[model samples]
Structures are given as structure tokens and as C-alpha cells.
Target: MLYIFDLGNVIVDIDFNRVMGVWSDLSRVPLANLQNSFVMGEAFHRHERGQITDEEFAAAVCDEMGMALSFDQFAAGWQAVFVALRPEVIAVMKQLREKGHRVVVLSNTNRLHTNFWPGEYPEIAEAADKIYLSQEMGTRKPEPEIYLKLLQEEGTPADRAIFFDDNADNIKGAQQVGITSILVTGKETIPAYFANNPC
Candidate 1:
């Protein structure tokens, strides 16, 4: 069986509040305002969909927040959101691999995150058979196209694959594509799910 996992808040810890805090401190923009203007903005969606370049996204964020941070500075603050890998999840993935299950990462993330986390957590990069990112795929989760793309690229039938993600919508997307899916709620739930399901 094939096992597909989501990156943020699933295999790894991520805090958008941290990103907001860093940007807030650097730009002097109120957290709520930043969240509203940038986090919930079209620029972010465009960037995640690979519709815009990193420089364009950074510039848009800076213009929206009225900050003057350079591209490198903005990227630094943006990449600060990832905390660490959830070791238990990594262990589960390793166990799955040992048992001969194919494991892969599917995340609705931009280039900055994709570039940063793998380097920061080499174990995550090493754990997966392949990693699929939204920016590279030109599609994001909760969208059937990306799920279909993954199945097509991997030559895995949807019925033979299992997907785990923290978002209900993403899980629904997988289900829509006819893949078995689990809605991961917390770190402990992963091992419990594995124990009950047994791949």
C-alpha cells in the first residue's frame, strides 16, 4: 500500500502565529492586520499555486505591511514558522517503510517552505519516497487535480493508496479522488491510527 502524508502540522510542527509574530516585529504591523491583509490575501494563494514568483510574493507582502525588509530578510521571517519534526510521526513513517509501504509527502506549501524544511529537517526529506509540493505542481490540496496528479505520476491507483492530512478539506479531496484517507488530529493519534489500521 502507498502512504501519503501532509507536511505541516502532520509530520512536522508549524505555527503561523510565529510567522505573524516575526513579521509583526519586523514590519511593526499589528498581528491581526497582518493576518487579515497578508495571510488571508490573494498574494499568498497565488504564491502557493505557483502563479507568482517568490520575489513577487515578498514584494506584495512588504507593500501590504508597509515594511522595507529585503527578500532575504522576508524569507528568513517567513521560514521561521516551522518548529520541528514530530518524532513519533517520523517513527511511524520509518516503521511503514520497513514494512515495505511506499511513503510520500504531499503538501500545499510554497517554495520558501519547501526549500527551508527539507534542509532544516533532513530526516523528513530522507523518510519519504517522494515529496510533492503545491508550488512545483501548480496545484494545492482540497483540489482534485493535485491528488490525481500524484496518483498519475506515481502510477498508483487511488484505491490502493492511503492519505493522511490535518485538514478536513484535504482529506475530502483525497477521498474525492477515491483514495483512503485519515484526518490526523494530533501527534498521538497517528500511532493509534496506525495500530488500529495496520497500514
Candidate 2:
């Protein structure tokens, strides 16, 4: 059996509020304004979809927030949202791997987050058979094409694979492609799911 997982809020805990706080402090912008300007903007979407480079995203966000931080500083603040890996989830993944189930990670994340995560949580890189990012794929979740691409890459039938994600839209997207998906809500949910539904 093939098991696919989402990175953010699944294998790892992240808080966008942390990002808002960091950028607000560094840019001297009000939290409300920064949230309204950058987080809800098209620039962020473009960045996630690999339409823009990191430097370009930094410059655009700086302009939007009326900040003057250098690219390095901006990148640091931008990538500070991740808190830590969910150890239970990682353990579940490792267990699945040991059982000979193929495990893969699929996330709708940009280069900045991807660059920082592997260094901080090496287990993610070590555990998964393969990792797919929206930035690298030029597509994001809830989009059928991205799921199709993964299915093609793995040469696995959609119905034969199981996926878990924190987002409802992404879960529905996976279902649309005929893959069984679980919408994980909490850290313990996935582990419980695996315990109840053995491959």
C-alpha cells in the first residue's frame, strides 16, 4: 500500500501567527496590516505556486508591508513559522516504512519553507520515499493535476493509495482522484487512524 501525507500541520506544527508576529516586528508594520497585505495577497499565492522567486517575493512583500529589510532578513522572518515536528506522526511514518508501505510527502509550500524544514527536521527527509512540493511542481493542492502527477510518478492506482492532509479541500481533491483520504484534525488523529485501519 502507498501512503501519502501532507507536511504542514500534519508531520510538522506551524503557526502563521508566528510568521505574522516575526514579519511585523522586523518590518515595523502593524500585525493587522501585515496580515492583510501579504498573507492574503496574490504575491503569496504566486510564490507558493513557483511563479515567483524568493528574492522577488521578499521584495514584493517588503513593498506591500512598507518595510526595508534585506532579502536575508526577510527570508529568516518568513521561514520562522515552523515550530517543530510532530514526533508521533514521524513515528507512524517510520512504522509504515518498516512495514514496507511506500510513504511520500506532498505539500503546497514554497522554496523558503522547504529549504528551512529539512535542516530542522532531518527525519522528514529520512523517512519519506519521496517528497513533492508545490513550488517544485508548479501546482498546489485541491488542484486535481498535482494529485494526478503524484499518482503518475508513483505508478500507483488512485484507489490503491491512502492520503492524509489537514485541509478539507485537499482531502476532497484526493477523493476526486479516487484516492482514500483522511482529513487529519489533530496530532493524534493520524496515529489513531493508522491503528484502527491497518494496511
Candidate 3:
């Protein structure tokens, strides 16, 4: 079996509120307004798709939010989203590997985030046999092409793989590709699945 997992919110905890809080302090934009303006719009998607530079994304965000912060300040707020490692999910992944199942991570993330987290959450990266990033792959989640590409590259059949992600659309996308997918809502997600499925 090939066990696929999403990086943020699954193997590692992420809080967009953390980003909001930091940016709010820097931009003085009020949390609510900042949250409202921080839409995952075209520019955000493009950044994750490796179609734009980090500075471009920062400028787009700044323009949309009416912020005058420099790129360094923006990057700090962006990196604040990551909180810590999800040890429970990491344990399950390790067990899955011991059971002879291959594991990998599929995340829709940008270079800034990609460059930052691995060092802090090295175990999460090490737990997986390989990590797949949307920015590096030039494709993001909820896309059929990325799923097809991952499966082909890993030489894993759709039916033989099970994917866990926090996003509904991403879950649906994996299901559309004929891979069993679980929506991770809380800590019990990965553990409960492993308890019942044992794979």
C-alpha cells in the first residue's frame, strides 16, 4: 500500500490565524480585515503552482491588504503559519512504513513555506519516503493532473493508495482519481483510520 498524506494540518499543525496575528501587528490592519483580505485568490494559487516569485506574491498580498511592509516582514508573517509537528500522525506514518506500506507527502505549498518548515519539522519530512510540493511540481491540489503525475512517478496504483488531507476538495480530487482518501478533522483522524484499517 502507498500511504499519501498532506503536509499542513495533517503531519504538521498550521494556523493561518498565527499569520494573521503577526501580520495584523505589523500592518495594523485589524485581524478581521486582514483575515477577510487574505483570500487564497489567483495570486496565492499561482504562487503555489510555481508560476510566480516569492516577492511577487508578497507584493500582491500587500496590495490587496493595503499593507506597506517589506518582503522580509511579509515572509516572517507567512512563515508564522506553521506551528509544530503532528507527532501522532508521524507515529502512524512510521507504523505504516514498518508494515511495508510506502509513504509520501503531497502538499500545495510555495517556495517560502517549503524552504522554512523542513528544517523545523525534519521528522515529518524524514517520515515520508518522499515529499511532493505543488510549487516544485508546478501543480496544486484538487487537480487531476497532479494526482496522476504523483501516482505515475511513484508507480503506485490508485486503488493501492490511501490519502489523508484536511481539505475537502483535495479529498474529493484523490477520490476522483480512484484513491481512497480520508478527511482529517482532528488528531483522531490518522490514528482512528489506522486502528480500523491497520494499513
Candidate 4:
């Protein structure tokens, strides 16, 4: 059996809104008000793909705000709100891998977020036979094409693969492509899904 997991809310605690709040306080940039012009999806996508460096992204925001802040300062402020991984989630992932399952991570994340993953949470990455990250793949979830691409690359039949995610829409997207799925609300509940099923 192959187990695919989402990274962000599934593995770690993240509040991008909190990061923006902290950034606004420190840099005097009102990210909320500049939603359309600065903090929209395209700007974030460029930042994620490294098309724009953190420094460049910050400068763009600063330009809109008529303020200036260094790259180091921006990075520090942006990273301040993130929290650690839940122990239960980590333990369950390791257990899944130990059972000889082909476990992998399939996450919709920016480059910055993916960069922060390794070393800090090696267990999560190591449990995976491989990882499929959105930024690297240039495709995000809740999109059928990405799921099809993953199935092709992993060479795993859709029905034999099980995907776990915190979002219902992503779960739906997986189902649309014939990949079985579970909404990971808690760790204790996950093991039940693995039972009574044969790959």
C-alpha cells in the first residue's frame, strides 16, 4: 500500500495570516489591505518558485508600503509564527513506514516552506519513499491534473493508493482521480483506515 500525506497543516502548525500580522507590525506594511495588489496568489506563487527571492518579495511589499526592510529582517519576521509538529502525527507516520508501506508526502507548499521541512523534521520526509511537492511540481492540490501527474510519476494505481489531507476539497480532488482518501483530523483515527484493506 502507498500512503500519501499533505505537509502543511498535517505535519506542522502554520498560520500565514499570523506571519503577515507579525510582518505588518515590524515593517509597517498592511498586508491585509494590499490583498489584491501585493499579497495575491501570483505574487506568492512567484515567491514560492524562487522567481522572486525573499528579499525581492519583501522589497515589493515595502515599495507598496513606502518603507524599507532588509531580507534577513523579513525572513526572521515571517518565520516567527510557525509552531512545532504534533508528536502523534510524527509517530503515526513512522509507524506506517515501519509496516513496509510505501509512504510519501504530497503537499501543496511554497519553496520557502519546503526548505524549512528537511533537517527540522527529517522523520516526516524520511518516512516517505519519495516526496511530491507542489512548488517543485508546479501544480497545487484540489486540481485534478496534479493528482494525475502524481499517479503517473509514482507508477501507483489510483485505487491502491490512499491519500490523507486536512482539507475536504483536496480529498475530493483525490477521489475524482480514483485515489482513496481520508481526512486526517486526528492521529489515533488513521490506523483504522489502514486495516482490512489489501493492496
Clashing pairs in 3: none
Report the lDDT tens digits of candidate 1 across residue range 1-199. Answer: 8899999899998888888888888778788887776554788878989999999999998998777788987998899889888999989888899999899999988988877787889998778889899898998888899999999999999999999999999999899989999998888778999888886
User: Which residue pairs come into collision in candidate 4?
Assistant: none
Q: Best by TM-score, which number?
A: 3
Give the alpha-carbon lDDT of every model: 0.88, 0.89, 0.92, 0.72
Q: At residue 181, give the lDDT of candidate 1.
A: 94
Q: Each candidate's root-mean-square deviation in Å?
A: 1.6, 1.5, 0.8, 3.5
The TM-score measured for candidate 3 stands at: 0.98
Model 3 off-target regions past 4 Å? none
Among all windows of 10 consecutive residues in model 3, the one with the lowest summed lDDT is 190-199
Whole-structure CA lDDT of model 1: 0.88
Candidate 4 minimal-lDDT segment of 10 residues? 33-42
lDDT, model 3 = 0.92
Question: Residue 166 error for model 4, in Å?
Answer: 1.5
lDDT of 4 by residue, 65-87 (tens): 55466766666656754667766
Cα error of candidate 3 at position 198, Å: 1.1
> Residue 102 in model 2: shift from native, Å?
0.5
My TM-score estimates for the predictions, one after another, are 0.93, 0.93, 0.98, 0.78
Q: Tell me the lDDT of model 1 at 9.
A: 90
